[model samples]
Target: MSWTHTFTNLCDWYTHLLHNSPTGTIHIHILRNTITSNPDNVEHILKTRFDNYPKGKPFSTILDDRLGKGIFNVDGDYWKFQRKMASLELGSVVIRSYAFETVMDEIQTRLIPVMASKAHGENGTEIKTVLDLQDILRRFSFDINCKLSFGLDPGCLLPSLPVSNLADAFDLTSKLSAERAMNVSPMIWKMKRFFNVGSEKKLREAVNVVSNSANEIIKQRREMGFATRKDLLSRFMGLINNDDIYLRDIVISFLLAGRDTIAAGLTGFFSLLSKNPRVEEMIRKELNQVLGPDQESPTFDQLRQMHYLNATVHESLRLFPPVQFDSKHAEEDDVLPDGTIVKKGSRVTYHPYAMGRMKKIWGPDCLEFNPERWLKDGLFVQQDPFKYPVFQAGPRVCLGKDLALMNMKSVVAALVPRFDIRVVEPHHEPQFVPGLTTTFRGGLPVKVIEKKMLST
Candidate 1:
């Protein structure tokens, strides 16, 4: 594959190589990277032989500065310890309820009102308005994450929607960290860091800003005596004491996990919904049946019962996964399940974006945005994790999977039934921004008009 072309069209380039390859895999000699879209290979790397492929030094080096020793960027006992603690906190019913309540509060109090103000004129007269839905969702997710992760509200979704220094710094940190992976040579970024110049200088400033903010939150929580709070940071503090840096890492990781992924998923989902009115209608119908014409926030059980909405969310994830591809380095020489050799230090990646588009994996209509593929007999059907590793697979599967789905479903349940979102550039394909998460290059521009009727 041409490096120039791959750089230009990352997902498409990977899809072309994987589909055209006889082995469903391709190796880029220049980068010593192996890319695979095969489910068997994905299973082998993620589950069957998981230990051999750790995040390794190369992958960790890119994110280590920003993530520290957080669960996402670490491996071995470090990862296991953090994972166990996180699992306990994330699995608790009380925490789930807290998170759900936070999301609902944001949506009801902030999200809806802001969008309504935009849809209606500033003074409340009827007006057609265009807004960047991507920006709106990002603000929504950031506010929710701040509350759930740090037990603080950044007020990002307020009417003024003030620009947040912490949020901006976090965004720059993520972009620069991702850029470290994309550089043809690590030396480029390494030298920049050593000299404290250019993007590297900006990266350092951003990381410091984020770290200081996290430290302040942790300090304040401690000063408050780590009161019985429901947020993740509070729960973590209850477990471990007086380790500020470690606590900061945990909070930052959760912020990234909870904020960007869900925001990106919602942005992609709404963008797809604007083009596919039938899917939007189906979601509205399900919401109506589940929550009635009043369109109240869904209870846990009610959220689960909206299978069509769930399927639509799954379909959106299938197409535009927040993390398009993930790389793991081999600990030693090994063989993939499909007879591909993996040398020590090789970067082996399973391309979720490409796998989602592969006809062999998803059938002839793979490229189409059809939610029916995920539904059978009016119920949502679970797919093999290896084939749909959006939240990943095996022992390292995302612990926040349940929380993320609930958040997405709740937002859809509350919003879709009340608004008609029309994409301003329906025919224009938005380019993907290369970052830690998948974001649109410019933004998803749309016109959101409040529905006249309360019923679907």
Candidate 2:
């Protein structure tokens, strides 16, 4: 199989192993995990019998120190309460509008201008060389999330592209925490944490930086008064009466969710688009058709109406889900719909990363990045959640699905028509780094060509 040679691509390696398994499942005894790519098993774990598989204590303990009771790291009553409140806030039309406007403003004021400068080059020279597109997108995402989550502009995405300590700390902490999860035995990591040595000590220091930075944001909000602010942090502060730590966790959760996921999506999308210029051309053609004259960017409603762009984004996510795999522990011994036996207290993981490449689930050409798979009769058709649980499924589906899509679509709408991004190594498949979200190993280096639009 082609995936046999893709050892560097961890997801493809998993897909290769899963393909060989008769039940579309495998047990990595060393890691103490029962990983499955079967959609039936996924539906069973995520929806059909979700109660039996809350992110149990064992699963929560790994991320507990960093996430600290955030919405993504809690269970039972805590998860329910946070989910309810987050749903109310994220689902509100006003908040959605606020998020979209913030995204558009960031792209217009920061992202596009940066690309334009890069294309024009310094000293009147049209320099054609590699720029770390990944870094720029990450900065852009960080800035947008900071604005939406804390009402603070980190200025990380400015023309100078300054750095933020909180962002660097979060990156290190996420990398260390994910490393903890991949450990064959928890005892080693636990012992390190207890002794405060090695990676664990580094993790602790990074987390402290994050905590202290969060405190500053909260203090700033309180001092300035959150009465009329529309950001998530302000809204959360005004709505909840929790202690400062809990409030901090809530907003940090939003920042974590909003930042990396969008960057990952856009990164992977542009990477593929560079490899497939035909796809990029089709997208620009769709934009020309869907957007009217004098419209430099599509409005929220018009963005939603762009089926081709929607399908393209969905296709990118299928191939490169930000959170590639997720696990829920069994509270009691149970049998999955696919007849996979689950032992009490065992970690059962559903691998969206593998699922996307499964021949049975998505057909023989699953390895190909084809957006047409999502289209039907000239419009994009939604897939079943279990089959594509990239945003998760059932009760815990991502609250920011629409908002994330809007952010991505807005970036595409604003940039695709003006900039042509060419990946430095279009054919080289990137080995993903181990983190809470998908990130390329060496970052996506690219050459940006500014497109000239005819004056209307």
Candidate 3:
């Protein structure tokens, strides 16, 4: 297949191959890449016989300039050490509660107020205002993640909605890094890098901006003397002495994970809800019953009891996962569970985006946006990690899974009850932008109206 075709509609192209191939795997020679939507193959690469599949040098080289030896970009001892530290910190009750508190504060103080201002007309007359919800949510998540991960607030969610240099640079770095994975040959990008021209130049500048900002934050925190803060950076600082470079890489990884993933998930969820009013209504009913008619933010326990709302979020993730695909390189020649021989130095990617649409995996109604698939006896049903690897599976499973879900649910609970959101172009299908994470090509534009009862 041509790189142009693969680039044009990545998810569709992967799905097409999965449907046609008997083993649910396809090989592309551009990078000697193997893409699979097979759950057994996914389990093999991610869990069973996992040692053979590492992020490898190619994957590391692409992201090393930006990510460094951060947990997401490294393998072996480096990844294991950071993973152990983060797992313990992220799993703590105190950290979870602190994260929830931060999310609620952001929602109540910034997100809701911004939406309310947009929903209410300047003269106090009832009028729906057109807003790009994707941008708003991105700003909202950026502030929350900065506060939670670095103990610093970028103030991207303020009334002015100021532009954030760190956020923009991070976005550019991530996009360019992902673009490297699609190159027909590494020589092209290597030549550009060697010449210090074009996108590579922009990437270098962006990485410098991001790195400098993170280093400044670290220096400031160090000067303040690592207080008993619950933020991830503070916790890591307590463990790893004074390595600011390592700290910067870790902070960037957490920031990317926390901000982009939540924003993408919420964007896809709201977009889907606009097309499916019944699901939105069901979510509102669940919220109304659990939190009462008052627009109070949900407590951790209250958020836990929101089964239907949880199911809807899961349904959204199933349909539009934040990270569409992940790649690993083989350490040596080995065979996948489904008898596909893996060659040493070959890149293998498992497609969560295509897996969600597979009839074999999700059954006959796979294409339907039905939240009921995730509910049984009015409680959210857990699918196997290999089958639903949106947060990924095995040892590298996301440490922030619970925190991400809580942040997402809190935003949904806080916003959905107070306002009605309608997609401005209801009939238009969003064009997916292929990058480190999946996001709409432009942005999700919507019209928001304050609910009369909630406003009163």
User: Candidate 1 on 1-456: residue-level lDDT in tens?
Assistant: 454544566787788889998878999898999999999999999999999999999888898889998989899998999999999989999899999889888989999888877774223455556799999999999999999999989998999989999889999999989988889999999999999999899999999999999998888888887567899999999877868898889789999999999999999899888999999888877777877766477888899888888899999999999999999999999988788999999999999999999999999999899999989999999999999999999999999999999999888887887788888889886788779898998898888777753334
Which residue runs does candidate 2 get wrong by more than 4 Å? 1-6, 120-127, 453-456
Total clashes, candidate 1?
Answer: 0
lDDT string, candidate 2, 1-456, tens digits: 365464887677788889888899998776667999998899888888989989888767998878888999989887998898999999998788888889888988999888887774223355556789889999999999999998888898889887789889988988999999767788989999999999999999999999999898888878888888889988888777658899888888889999999999999888888888788888989999888667798989999889999999999999889889998889899987767778888889999989998889999999888999999998999999998999999999999999999999899888887888888888786989988899999999988777784346
Model 2 alpha-carbon miss at residue 209, Å:
1.3
Better by TM-score, candidate 3 or 1: 1
lDDT of 2: 0.88
Judged by lDDT against the true structure, how good is candidate 1? 0.89
Q: Which ten residues in a row have the lowest lDDT in candidate 1?
A: 120-129
Q: What shift in Å separates residue 308 of candidate 3 from its native position after superposition? A: 0.6
**Which whole-number lDDT from 0 to 100 does residue 104 have in model 2?**
86
lDDT (tens digit, per residue) of candidate 3 on 423-451: 88988867787588888987999988777
As for candidate 1, its clashing pairs are: none
